[model samples]
Target: MEFKGKLSLWQRIVRAFESFDSWTAFSLNESGRRFGAAYARYAEAMDLFQVRGAKRVGVEILGEGLTLGVGGLLVMLALALPAFREVGGDDWLKKQDLAVTFLDRYGNEVGRRGIRHDDSVSLDEFPDHFLKAVLATEDRRFYEHFGIDVIGTMRAIAVNARASGVVQGGSSLTQQLAKNLFLSNERSLERKIKEAFLALWLEFHLTKSQILKLYLDRAYMGGGSFGAQAAAEFYFGKSIKDVSLSEAAMLAGLFKAPTKYAPHNNLPAARARAADVLSNMVDAGFLTEGQVYAARRNPATPVDRKRETSPDFYLDWAFNELKHLSDDGKLGGDRVLTVRTALDVSIQKQAETAVESMLRQYGDSYDAKQAATVVMDPDGGVRAMVGGRDYGASQFNRATDALRQPGSSFKPFVYTTALLTGKFKPTTIVTDAPLCIGDWCPNNYGRSYSGSMPLATALAKSINTIPVRLSIAIGDGNPKIGRARIIDICRLMGLTTPLVDTVSLPIGAAEVTVLDMTASYAVFANGGKKADPFAAVEVRNSRGDVIYRRDRDLPAPKQIINANVIADMNGMLVKVVEEGTGKKAAIPGVRVAGKTGTTNAYRDAWFVGFTGNLVAGVWFGNDDYQSTNKMTGGSLPAMTWHEMMAPAHQSVELKPIPGVPTTPGGKDAVASASGPKGFEVAASPQRPAVLNPRALDAIGGIDSMMKSIVTRRGPSAFLEPAAETNLFGAARSVGGRMALQ
Candidate 1:
């Protein structure tokens, strides 16, 4: 205006441009030259039109000013033609990207990432006043504008020119919707033109309400929240309908800069910004001064909710599964997937808490720096998993990724393999004496020996020598039983890790993951059915259509082992908890059957077990393979297992271990040796050939002890009378100087 008042019209334009910095002055001059050229072309076209009209009328018809005005209209129409072509395409009207949400087993939302659409609400669901507040804060003339606001654009340009940087955006709500939906956020002349064109397209195609809805649904709120309803829920912990005027103003203020004005991060700054929005609302006539004052008095503060545990481990596993199930195992861009997972969030939290607590409690004393736990159902649904003490500190999923040796936890499979061959029963006496197979010599912990004991007793105590001797006997050039037989059993039980056929294989030298181990234990829990542990149960799209759903009724689980073998395995494992190494893991009212494991030099301690309904596996050790301070499987690992499983079974029904005898104390009693419900163990026709004289002598002592115990107990509940081996010897005394393994 100053330049216009001081000089002639032409001189005023030139002087005003000359006063600008180089870039602004150059842009203004270039625009003027283009405008002049267009005007010249339009002038020529108008003159031709006038000549034709005058030729018809025999006189000049139209005035020069009117003709020039009509010619300018034609030039403007030509400039707008390209934008029409660009926005007329079908792709321009597609929906914005929807985020993925993860729900727990009971259909409660546990996590959300990507652009989650599960909680998106329609515009009709929001209060009218909230919508009014949004429009007032963002665009007061939204209903009257075509698409681009010329006055707003000019004001923004002037402000930016003065600042020498971008300080404001001239986008209306619809224009912002266009940019968010179809364009990248890049500052360039071409992109700006496209944004303007798309905004016009949106206004032409959608109603004002539709454009506002799109904007509200796609806007980013802080703390991984997107959309209006999610933002409200994230900040206020309530539905959009329940948001007060002040809360609505606060949410509206976040549109300008979510993190900058995020009340969760800086309350004072957010309140100040909200005050600006409230003032805007008052000025826009959407709110009265009194209303604005009332709103300003009660500002909404961001909710102080922090996630209990990082669900990254579970989500990462689910995402991999989702990708594998998608076309060609690839996830395309901007997908909206709802995964219904088998995770029990409560149990997961408990597991995480237990791991951290255990580490804190015993880490210094035991030199144990890392631990992992996995909980699963008998039907193969994973309930809870703690991959590490802190997922934020380390994202590596030790439960699913680390393949440490399971040690004695692997003994169950070895015992199951022996039992499945019909040659061994839980009570079948096995020698616990020290034995050397060629160059390999195995020793029990503390070099202890129970002389000769029942197969169940040796397993209960985790006597290392007996399992090795049994593996050697089963695999000793026998056509029926190979050294690798336990490997096949492990695979059937869901252990995917490879195993070696060494003599020590039965003592759990094979490396395996916690998930596989837990699933393997579930086989016994499910009564011999093979459990295929899974995470995702169903997946849905943005429109509430299920893209994938697991078929729960897949042909009955493959029967790997007989029900009798499972029963016998259950009985023996129960005894382990009752009277052996796993006694620390016993839940007083509920029956549990499991095994304890300790690796060489106490590098790894594992406790894997199962209740009637749930199976759990726990591991304790240093990540770098350093030995713990003599922490056996019965110590921290068992304690952590108890801590996790006790809470998990609180609401579960009390059930006895199938085929086991409950104690006179009730549901926890040892099984009758005759077995549950007249269950009979068939005697083997051919007995194992005792190759070593020491083994033969050891077996004779075991037979005599079994005979003595059976006599005293009037049919021992666990041990059965064994068909005596050929070699015989006097029975050794019961107690030994060394401690039991």
Candidate 2:
């Protein structure tokens, strides 16, 4: 002060200006000390001004300098204020909607098509290690920063400058949240400014924890996953809270680049990234060096993509049913829904395994590239379904889509029609001889016949001629019988496929879906009641409100066939499984009843059968309807049915078919003269074996043949002598004196 007292006011002002320059340089280096120095500079410059209006030259100069400095800062802030006000708020988050979820019958998640997730994890529910792992890998100075980290920014700038490109990002967690919530990923200076402003706004409006939750919930994980919970499940098949430290590290490493670090996509790169995250965890004190070493050895295994399989066959079918019931005309938009299906997941797995196994074992050998299976209850509730061997390879629901000929499987419906008319009985004899009608002729499976065997025997052998004759007798346009009566019966039994009015219709010449055929079979299984097969049972919306439920009582099933007719049908079908072509379909303790069907040229092989508890159908064939390698319905289709039904019925109690004789030690005999296994059953001595000659003539196209048979002694008038005879055929009641086996 003594040295400065002798100086002029102008000199003092010049010295003050030099001192301000020094303070400015110091302020640029140290932000904490800048405010004090700036205030001192201003006060010292003000002292140069006079108390009165007449000011000195030094005072005027100082006033001009202060005005320009302060005025320039004010102008900049004024321009920036509008940009800061443009930051988004909570309404930005509200624009995003949640995804839909699909649940199985037992309330377990089976599959999801959209951005699915569990309930949001609160700050208290989020594990500390998971949070630490995320922060340590993503941002270490999260809490210390107010929207932006200056030191981190400067370091990142230096590093990027040396690299000649963006090698590091200085964004804070709040900044990341802001970008994820509202901003686009355009890498421009303008976008960066908006990101910074939005980050500052978020930091001021929300707590640190809230910002973290937003990031976790909005981050897009790989494999169609949208949130942390979904990512945990999609990547490691575990919940967020249950994730181990090593697993947390691996998952946290995904935030930088989800698909690039997805273990399933690139395990080595994922591991490398995870190692860095683990090292960061150790540096952050979340884990010790030893712990990190151990974690490196046992990183999380990638989620098994196979285990998360969606039963697309069942789910797709269920969704179709759901679509019709939804109020908004779609599934899983904003409203979360729970679709309760009738599918038995365990049985469904067994069905899928059986189908795939059969395809692998015999697909190439049989020229059968695909297969479909369906298991359902008597009331038409689908228990299990496999629409194809590999749904990923082909999504066509063969079980419900492909309308191939049912072949001999359609014979049962024809038989049912005859039985319901009271003109035919299981024990009634039918001549299996060759018959031609208007350029059409039908034959047995092997072009061989059993002469005049009973109706049960003809069906057991799946004799083609008999069903054709029966359909002609019942379906022809006669005064007593209407035209295409068999088609009417099929429709009543739930066969939706169109059938032409042709003589070959009885031998399954028409096309029909597996679902329709399966439901038709359920009519006999349910004691003649027509059951419309259904997949979904009920549906509930996001708020747990019941949207729709299946009306099990609605549209009560009609008794299309009489109980006595069904009983006879069940008994005869049982013999088909017990001793006939469907023997491979038999279970040791369970009475099985089904039919074997091989379409013309072996294009389709099918075994449609049922136990006391369930009815299932199996179909194996080429998609183009090409011939197989001599694969018959009994070989592959019946075996596949057995493989699936055996496991499905394991927990079910064994019981006999509804009308089958279950008396222990009572022998059921078959008589076939054509081969070693002629499917001709002999009735007990107490039951009468009769044949209506008139009905036979009507179907056989042999006018006056039955009239001529009356003069014959043996009632085997329509029979043709067997070329070769089996021991059972020797005891035939038609003509031979064979003994009962």
User: Which residue runs does candidate 2 get wrong by more than 4 Å?
Assistant: 1-109, 113-312, 327-334, 476-483, 500-502, 545-547, 551-556, 661-741
Question: What's the alpha carbon RMSD for model 2?
Answer: 25.4
lDDT of 1 by residue, 1-741 (tens): 444345579986887777776778789999999999999999999877665543755544445667888998897576656646655467654544535688877566887655533235778988877888888878888888898888888888999999999887788787777777776768777666677777887887888888888788787777677788888887888888789888988898989888898888888998998889889888888878987787788777778866555577877666666666654432333377888888877667767776887788678899999999889878788878888877888889999999899999899988898888788998898887867767888888878788878999989989998777777666764512555777888898899977766767788887999999999999998888889878877777666666665653245688888999999999999989989998778766667789999999999999999887689999999889999999988888887777677666553334555576543456333222121112122211221121222343355457666667567665643343342321122333312221211
Provide the clashing-pair count of each candidate structure. 8, 4
Candidate 2 residue lDDT tens string, 1-741 = 455448889988999999999999887879857777999999999877536565566678888999998998887576556546555444566645335456655456776544555547776777777888889978889989998878888999999999999888888877877777776778877667777777888888888878888888777677667668878887887788788877887888888888898888888888888889989888888788987777789877877664356688887776666555554553334445776667777778777876777778778888889889889888898878888888878889999989898899888988988887778999999988888877878877777877898999889988888887786667553412432788888889998877777667888888988888888898888888888988656667777765565663257777778888999999899989887899877755567899999898999999999866789989999888889998888878888777767655543334555677553522232111111122211211221222222232233333233444446534553354441243124223333321110
Assess each prediction's global lDDT (C-alpha) against the native.
0.76, 0.75
Candidate 1 weakest ten by summed lDDT = 671-680
Per-candidate TM-scores read 0.56, 0.55
Error of 1 at 70 (Å): 38
Candidate 1 TM-score to native: 0.56
Error of 2 at 58 (Å): 59
